[model samples]
Target: MDQDQQWLINCLNASLDPNHQVRNFAETSLQQASLQQGYGLALARVAANRELPFGIRQLAAVLLKQYIRKHWNEDEEGFEHPIVPSNEKVSIKGILLASLDDPYKKICTAISVAVSTIAHYDWPDDWPELVPFLLSLINDQAKLNAVHGALRCLALLSSDMDDMMVPKIVPALFPCLYTIVSSPQIYDKSLRCKSLSIVYNCSSMLGVMSGVYKTETTALLLPLLQPWMEQFSSILK
Candidate 1:
């Protein structure tokens, strides 16, 4: 059993190796491990270990997350198998949130990938617990793509919630978004405009029908649009 475990671990690590055949063996081992004694949790530790090679550990993390996401959803039979929670579990979202500041570019990219995958699953009402973390990432200049991806994921997560959720979400998001809109920096200008476009596209989805949109929309746009038109008229002179 010890030798077999060693052989399996070797195979698993090999799959992450640069060599193709070794990688294939590793894939086969993970498949076998899924069907064997410890199941996914056995491999999860191997993935979560920071001491491991970043690429190999990341591969393990991705596989383990896929396994967790599949069976954890009551609505969808994720991965179509029973999942055992790991003893030393890692919060996938929490890790990604931290990754927004990772000095490594690939780590930032990995967090973006993780956010995209997690957003596909059904999130609970309490899921807004991560909003502050996502909001923090929105200002991370070092990893703009991660911030952009986080904002998009936040938008998607909030979009399906009740109107009760909006007040909690918008206040946190709007300030940064508004600053993005007002910034003279090229990247900030583009991000702010795109985010506002998304907000407007989904504006009618907001539960508050208190004329807030009518009051604010007209107030903000009329001045800008009217002045732009007047300038155009004068330019023709």
Candidate 2:
């Protein structure tokens, strides 16, 4: 079993090798071994490992995403086959979240995307605990990757949220979101813009909800252009 797992990591790592033969060999190995259980965790483990070469890590992350999208889901038969086991999920989340503090921008982007994918499957019902962790990170200014990854997942969650839950979610969500979008003092311009984008998209979704949420919609829309508008007229202000 240990040999099989190490074999999978080797295949993923080979993609970074300069030799075309080595790279092709790795690809074929993955294609063959991907059918086995525990493959998804192996890929994610490689991606989250800081000791690995960056290029190799990215290949692992991409494979992990592909593996996840193909296999893990709310199945038709309602059977449960978690390719990433329960204990592993917690450990993986911690690694991915901590990877947000990585200095490499590309690594940060990759980790954020992986986190977003995990949130898609785990949140709404399966995992409510992640919400608080992400929210706390969003409020933190010192760590850009943590903020970016957290906000990315939150935006993703809101995008697919049920209309029925809008009332319950929007009131709590908007204020934290507002704090991100409204603050010019935050060092990251990208975070500022992303926060506004979330507000813009969520506002539209909220707008279509029941009459009771009309005030919430109005509250969100009022600041729709403020962040970008401030940027366009920076000298005047």
Candidate 3:
């Protein structure tokens, strides 16, 4: 653990140097630390320091978030590895919720990653509380990149979810797709189309409630897909 801490400190410092290569090396180092135990939570504790470069700290925060969310609350029977607490009293979930306000995209990504992981679980009682957090990320302006990442995560996470959760999430999710599809403001056409495709796929997977979403989802998605598909078909010919 001491070696890992030293390695993290070295990486965090390297991330701040004027040299681009050093910064890149730091980024790589941090990414490696992300795979190690306790490193992510440790980085989270230090990421908000004013002395650290904003970019480096943001990357650390994001990595920390990914580690916590991906690993949290696994059932003992389902585990491939033993679950150990980073800190016995501090909730990883609480730390992630606080990260929603982080002033960096990397931190935002961490929060998004965490939310996506929670969305994959069967915590029906917890869903009402958790849904709002996930929905809030979907609308955050400063965290648009993270929002996109979270939405993709949510789209997949919600795929096999029950109807009660699905209905509530889809209404909010559909409009996001509509905005991405209908707006000319989005510059990358291919990416816009891809985002729409994910919404469509998730919409289809709603199974029984697919009918409930038909009017709104179809109204928003079908027009955009038809022309794009036709254009592709013509090109193939």
Q: After superposition, how far is residue 133 of candidate 2 from its true place, in Å?
A: 1.3
The CA lDDT of each predicted structure is 0.55, 0.68, 0.57
Candidate 3: list runs displaced more than 4 Å. 1-43, 46-71, 74-91, 97-111, 122-124, 140-146, 149-153, 159-164, 186-194, 207-237
- What would the TM-score be for candidate 1 when compared with the true structure? 0.58
List candidate 1 stretches off by more than 4 Å: 1-13, 16-20, 34-58, 84-90, 103-106, 116-122, 139-149, 155-168, 186-201, 204-237
The per-residue C-alpha lDDT of model 3 at residue 87 equals: 63
Model 1, residue 22: distance off in Å is 2.3
How accurate locally is residue 95 in candidate 2, as Cα lDDT from 0 to 100? 75
Better of 2 and 3 by TM-score: 2
The best-first sequence of candidates by TM-score reads 2, 1, 3
Model 3's lDDT to the true fold? 0.57
- Identify the runs in model 2 with alpha carbons over 4 angstroms from their true place: 1-9, 18-20, 74-84, 211-237
lDDT, candidate 2, equals 0.68
Better of 1 and 2 by lDDT: 2
Model 2 poorest 10 in a row by lDDT: 74-83
Q: Write the per-residue lDDT of candidate 3 for residues 1-237, one digit (tens) a residue.
A: 477656776787787788999989888876666555665467755564436666766766666545555455566334323243636214545555555555555555555565555545434565456656656765665565545555545555655566565555665666665555555454246436645666656656654555876676465546446655654475357
Worst 10 residues of 3 by lDDT: 80-89
- Reference-based TM-score, model 2: 0.76
Enumerate clash totals for all models, in the order shown. 2, 0, 0
